[model samples]
Target: MALHNKIGKIGEDIAVKYLRQEGYYIIERNYRNKFGEIDIIAAKNNYTIFIEVKSRSSENYIELAQSLYYKQIAHLRRAAIFYFSEKNIHLSLIRFDLIALKIDPAARRIDKLKHFKNIID
Candidate 1:
């Protein structure tokens, strides 16, 4: 895979790990439909979280989180709506999140990981 794709996959893994650590049950990963794909779907304590992951090898060169543009956000929103409607979910609350990851291939470690909650409508 290309470096970016690899980084993104790593980011998704990290996000899943972190969410599980936080007591969130992973509902799905890479959930896809006609609209688009959601990187992660999690549920806990009556709340559902829809996550978008962005990863970069080196943020010193380019920030990873900034890659999620307006159009991307729009698609995510559309996908979330579709998911809720298709699942017939009527939950107490729902949230959107962005998981930003920076990986160091040389070190074989994560340089940084940031979770931004409520990132979308």
Candidate 2:
């Protein structure tokens, strides 16, 4: 795979591990539809979460938090609605989460992982 793709996959793996450790039950990864793609779908307590994972190496950490745009958020919301309907899930306690990670694939380490809950709404 291309270097960026490899890094993305590694970052996703790290996000999954972190989510699991935090007691989120992973329902899916890379969930997609005509609207867009959701990186992770998980359930915790009373919420169904649609997560967008953004990762960068230490060299690019400064660019991490600003990656998501309003247009992308709209797409995610549309896709999430489709996902809920297809899965027969209710929208009552749904949330959108953004997990930004600073990772070092060469060292197999995550320098930082920040979770922003309900980021879209």
Candidate 3:
């Protein structure tokens, strides 16, 4: 794999750890369908959260938060719908969350992670 891809995977691992510590029960990691991939699917406060994790080496030009484009959101929404129907789960609530990770070279770790929920209507 390329270096960037490797770094992204590392960031995702960190995000998963962070979510677990925050009391989220992880149902799936890297959930994929014909549409796209959801970085994490977790249950929290009686709702299922579909997370999109974007990691970056710098906050230049674009911050990690900018990665959640509209097309991606649409794909995620479709995937979420498929997930619920395929599993036959009558869910009352669902959320789309964006997790941003910025890597700090000086600290040799992720400098920060931001979780944004309800990203779509």
Candidate 4:
């Protein structure tokens, strides 16, 4: 894989670890449908969460936070809906989340990770 894609996968891995630590049961990773791919799909406290993971080098921390645009957020919802439809699962408590990761270039380690819950309305 390319360096950027590899870094993104690592970011997703970090995101999964963080979510598990937060008591979320992972349902899937890199779940893709007609709309797009959801980086993580997890469940916690009766809610199903669709998450987008963004990763970047430490110097681009600001870009990481702002990377998720409005259209991307809409696509997340569309993907979630498609997932529910494909699985025949009724939507009860569903939400969107965003996980941003800033990695140290030299160490290839996470310098920062932030989880934003219910990021999309």
lDDT scores in order: 0.84, 0.87, 0.84, 0.85
- TM match of model 4 to true structure: 0.91
lDDT of 4: 0.85
Off by over 4 Å in 4: 60-63
Q: Please provide the root mean square deviation of candidate 2 (C-alpha atoms, Å).
A: 1.4
Taking the tens digit of each residue's C-alpha lDDT, what string does model 2 give over 1-121?
Answer: 8877777888899999999999999999999898999999999998999999888775565466678888998999999999988888766998999888888878878888888888876
Residue pairs in steric clash, candidate 3?
none
Query: Native-vs-model 1 lDDT?
Result: 0.84
Structural similarity to truth (TM-score) of each candidate: 0.89, 0.92, 0.90, 0.91
Better-scoring candidate (TM-score), 1 or 4 = 4
Off by over 4 Å in 3: 60-62, 105-108
Q: In terms of lDDT, which candidate is stronger, 3 or 4?
A: 4
RMSD of 4: 1.5
Which candidate wins on TM-score? 2
Worst 10 residues of 3 by lDDT: 58-67
Quick one: ranking by lDDT, best first?
Answer: 2, 4, 1, 3
For candidate 2, list the clashing residue pairs, or say none. Answer: none
lDDT of 3 by residue, 1-121 (tens): 8868876788788888999999999999999888788899999999999998888776631366676678988999999998888899998899988888887644548777788778787
